[model samples]
Structure formats: structure tokens, C-alpha cells
Target: MCAVEDHPHGTEEWWDRLGAVLFGPWAPQAQPGSGHVHCEPDWSWTLVLSDYDLWCVLGGIGRARLNGQDFTVTSGCVLMLRPGDEIEVRHDPANPLTVGYQHYTHGAEHRSATVADTCPPHFLPPRHVRLDDLSEVRRHLDGLARLRRRPGPDTRARVTAALAVLLLEIHAQAARGTGALPPLMDRRIHDVVEWLARHPTLRLGLHDAAASADLSADQFSRLFRRETGQSLREYQVAVRIRRACELLAESRMTVRQVAAALGYSDHHLFTRQFKDRTGTPPGAWRRSV
Candidate 1:
């Protein structure tokens, strides 16, 4: 029941009130830092990420509490406090607590002072989870904060692009947290991951991957899933899709050639799978990129 009041003041001060004001010591001075905040919320926030709120903690550490979950945070720990999940705070007065945060909408046209926004009032992620060592994530929030305040031709597009990176980070982390890849994961699985990524055309099955780790097929399947948090089938599909994107965007390959490179014999099936996962057909997606 010990909750911190929402301190919007530090964020404003941290980001120079999102205006032409000179940067404070806490914020970046020259690089025109990503449109993010370097805030010391002296009080703990009862709310974390709303359906419209996305946050990242860059420095300091604390414990975030949801209804049935808790997180030990450090510089790179990202929190997913889906709608309605309350992340209460308890900080040491002697040490102080500071967090890097950015709040924006996900195509949800809602505004402050109204809960009747278009998006769900409270949307929880598949689970309340913590992703670690996400170095690429913090900058997007900075970009979000920066673009939201500027006016130009591509402000909306810029903001949308930044938001995609942030959300993708969250979803990827959440997927990894699914007991398939515990925070303290095994080393062998890391090797398998490297192999799988490097040999996207190998078309691995449970036994084939397990053999790389000296494990039997059944043993490999269980341990691999337990260690990576994804079934062999699921993991391979993801790898294929990722490689497909790369070949499509960066190479002179047709969808059929790309599919063949990823071990998909049927280009039509590959197209269907790619569309299902990315919401865009392979050819169209490549063109846009």
C-alpha cells in the first residue's frame, strides 16, 4: 500500500521541459539526446506502462511490483507493466531512485484526463515480465520524446518507427521470459542459438539440434525449450523469418530464392508464413523497406 505519487516535475526538468531550454546536467547536451527523460521520481509511481505508456530504466536500481510479480532492476532492465498492472515503488531515501522513461500512445488516440480512450483501458502483457541487457531499447524512448515535441514532415512517422522498436523489444523479451529461456539460462543453449542462426538453411529438427549439444532428441527438445523458452519448431520458424527479411531487404533475391535459402521448399508456404508473422507479404514488405 506504500505507493509513490506521480511526479511529472522531474521529467520536465530532465528533458528541459521538452522545449528550446538549455539541457540540464542529467540530460544530454549536444547530441540532442533521444526525446526521453532522465527523471528521479523521488516518489514511487503506482502505475508503470499503461496501454499508452512505454518506459525504460537507464540508471539506478529498484524493485518493481505488479499484482503477482516483482523485478530487480538495473541499468538495462525493461519493465512490461501492461495496462492495470500496478508497479509500486519502495526506495531508499539515502540512495535515491532515478528512472529513464517515455510515455506515448500505440495508435491509441487517447489523451490525458480521460480513460475513455480508444485502446483498452487496461491491457496486460502476456505476463508481467522483465527483460535484461536490452541496450538498443533506451534510445528509442529518447527518439520518441524528441520527435513528439518537434514539428516537421515525418514527425508522426518518426515517432511510429521509434515506437515499433520499443514494442518489438518488449515482445521479444517477453517471449524469451516464457520459461523457455530463464534469465539464468544455460550456456549450451547459447551455442545452439548461434548455430541455428548461422545455419538458417540447415532445417534442424529436435534431434539434429540436440546432437550439437551431445543431447538425445527428446532430451534436447525438453532442455532446449526450457533453456530458450521456445520449442524447436517455433525457434526455427522465427530464425527463418528473420533471415528471410534480411535477404529480402538487403539482397537481390526473389521470395522463392529467399525461401529456398531458409530451407523452405515451397515458396508459397513461406509467403503464407511470412505474411502471418509480419502482416505483410514478402514482396511488399521488401519494397517498403
Candidate 2:
């Protein structure tokens, strides 16, 4: 019917309440659903959901009716269905849908209905978004699957943390109110950002990045700053530092090695830059993590 039904999770208050619980002591438990599904042509889905469900399309096309509202489903699309909502899904037989899904909820047992409305707007996140890079999100989904299969309190904790991170990532990618970049510009900038994020070690100068985007240096710089709120060099530095932090925390690499891997020829220079951005040396940050 393409009409959105009234549901608690569809409102800002519901998100606010959930946000409070998420950041509070009694955080929601993350339960991984069926990993990736290669749907058969005859397959269909319908449910009156009892928990928060996240569905990410991996491939193929489909149509979903959430609480009677229709949505076109395609690769990279993500849908968030909440308690008390109804969903029906079907796909084309020529190219059946493939999807990854997970569930999140409060308490040991799943709720039978929606919570009462009495919350804030601060926790409102996008209910749907088509990510520019799905692989990164896919990694988190797969990690959740792996963690859920393991038997340990530690793994369960990690699953919850991973779910939180995935939500935050979606929030960051979602467009907020007013003054978004034009679609073409947004896509171009997205490509640049994805490239920089994927190759933090590569030294891509401002002019080169501009050329890659088929724009003059000044034009590209202005557009990039307008779209991302950061200059090209600043963004690149931030990307490199973020990767450095990950390596320092998760890998056996020494600080010098990390610096070198990120294209910092001088280890001292990397340390100085890292300290300027993080207020501590890489080693200290690693230890704290």
C-alpha cells in the first residue's frame, strides 16, 4: 500500500528511549539471526516482529511491505524493523534476493509488544539507508555471526559492541535534515572518501585527488570541504590516524612499523602528528585500548 503505519519505533521518542537503554547499564542483547540467505524464487517472508530487526540486502532485488508500506529492495539497502511491526517480502524469480539479518532487544526474553512512548528525539537514527560501501557493513554482520556462534561471555559482549558500532556507522552515513550535497557531487565525494579510507597507506595528494574526480584543485577542495566539513589533507590525516589506532590496538606491529605502514617515513613525525590529533602518543593510546 506504500503507507507507513503508526509504530513506536517509527517515532523519535521510541529511538530516544532505546538510546537511553543502549548507553545505560541494561543494554540490549544482540542476537544474530540467519547469516546470509540465498533466497529461493518461491520464498516469501512475513512476520509480526517482536524485536528490532536489521536486514541488509547482499544481492538481487525484492519488494518489502513494512506495516503495509511498500519499499523497493536492492543491493546495499538496509532496513530496520521494530517490535509490533508487520513485514511481508517477496522477490523476482529471475534474480532471487540474498540478505543478512540480525535482531536486538532488551531483557532475556523478547517483548511481545512496543514500549510506551515517553522518550526524546536525540536518539533518532535513520531507519533505512543505501550505503556507498556495503563491504564494511558486511564485515560487521559476518563478525556478529561468528561471535554469536561462539560460547563465551566475552563473545557475547563483543557481539553487542559490534551491533552498536554498526548502528553508529549507519547513523553517520545517513543524511540528516537540510542542505545535502547534490546527488552527483555526493557520489563523487563518497568515492573519494571510500578510496581514502580503503588505502590509508597511499599518499594521494590534493591535486591527484582533484584530478581523479575530474575537477580543478580549487573546485575539488571547495566541494570536498562543503560535503564533508573537512579539507582534503585533514580528512586524509584523520583516516590514516584512525587506521593507525586500529593497528596499534589489534595488531602486533610496533609504533614505528605502524607509522611506516601508513606512509610516515619518519617515525618521530608520525608520533608528533598522532599526538596532535589524539592528545597522546600511539603507544599510550594502544595501551589504553
TM-score for each model? 0.42, 0.58
Clashes of each: 9, 0
- Cα deviation at 109, candidate 1, in Å, is 3.0
User: lDDT of all the models against the reference?
Assistant: 0.59, 0.74
Clashes in model 2: which pairs?
A: none
Candidate 1 has its poorest 10 consecutive residues by lDDT at 21-30
Q: Model 2, residue 43: displacement in angstroms?
A: 1.0
What stretches of model 1 exceed 4 Å from their correct place? 1-42, 47-51, 68-71, 108-127, 179-289
| lDDT value, candidate 2, whole model | 0.74
